[model samples]
Target: MTDAAPSPDIAVLLADDHDLMRESFRALLDASPGFRTAGEAGTGAEAIRLAREYRPDVVLMDVRMPEMDGIEATRRICADPDLSGVQVLILTTFDLDEYVYAALTAGASGFLVKDSTATELLNGIRLVAAGEALLAPRVTRRLIATFTGKGQPAGSPRGLDEITEREQEVLVLIASGLSNTEIAQELNVALGTVKTHIGRLLNKLDARDRAQLVIAAYDSGLVTPRSR
Candidate 1:
């Protein structure tokens, strides 16, 4: 008889200081299908070591940890050429914590509050593992507000000049918190066309995902909080 196809598994590395929290997360992730616990770390240093060794598909990183903290660890992981495929998902207890935006700037794919429902957490991991940014429109607004509130200098738009004018419009809409479907409807274009524009924007801007694209838009001054 022919052999059945192997099930796809998403390797995950759990990084948190609390034993109970780590254990709970491990139990939930292990019990879920398509997810396997590749390793666990009680500190940021350990997380970095285990990540280098396992090169997991997703790292559930806690923002606060001994020795390194999730932000620094995420920066290091993203800086590594060998770990390019790895995606870091930040975990925090507060939704409006200042560190959330910093973690994103440090190259995190997204953030999740500890109190999120089991379904939200699992779907978040799945989304990040699939190379998607998990920011919703409300979250995007909060991030933009945070940036402007801090009076952070706008980012340079040096790289953005490479894209076509239509792609520039799409980037601005993305930064304005519009999803592909929303952008398609607003621009009166096909959904496939919107996706194509976003894909090209990612390539031209050298952004990893939509979250980075949003950051780029703000940094480039293409979309400003004042304009929203």
Candidate 2:
């Protein structure tokens, strides 16, 4: 008996204004296993349209698309109830772009530096696709540091009323870029307890993932960027 053909499960949409950039990403995905390119979009408008058409597992969105910016695209994608399963991973030249906070606010799951190594990029894609956790700790720290003002994180942190004191503490550490293990050590609790707090935070805050948890913490003003 002949076996059926295999299909890559993680469908990815590449959205970038640059042809070369899209081609590069396509090549990388082509070479990697368990991934396949669903489609390509050279503009934010196109990205949104294709997102609805393809409903890929993840969209590698460039922030500076021609007709529409990725932030706007991300906002639309995230807001659309039909595209709930799709995750947007912002693509930018700098790891700590001024748009990182905006992208997160607009509903991006994580950031992907264009010049990142293949391993890092692939891992980021997989992580976002899984919706398991925040993409990167170092990048998360940089984002918080860049956006969160000294003494107080930017924006109005909301939904504090819904969670307990310990959950609130976990949010602060998450915003501060502490891993679950690190948070466990700092709080002198088991790692599973830290995970439980995060789970509660995610549920109470209506956040999509750890990335959104950081956003919520900043909005709530629970954590502030450390001074240099």
Best prediction by lDDT: 1
Write candidate 1's Cα lDDT for 66-125 as tens digits.
898888899999888999999999888655457878888789998888898999999999
> What is candidate 2's TM-score against the reference?
0.88
RMSD of each: 2.0, 3.2
Q: State TM-scores per candidate.
A: 0.91, 0.88
* Model 2 residue 144 distance off true place after TM-score fit, in angstroms: 1.8
Give me the runs in candidate 2 sitting further than 4 Å from their true place: 1-8, 133-135, 150-158
List the global CA lDDT of all models: 0.86, 0.84
Q: Write the per-residue lDDT of candidate 2 for residues 57-84, one digit (tens) a residue.
A: 9999989879899999999999999999
For model 2 the local lDDT of residue 94 reads: 61
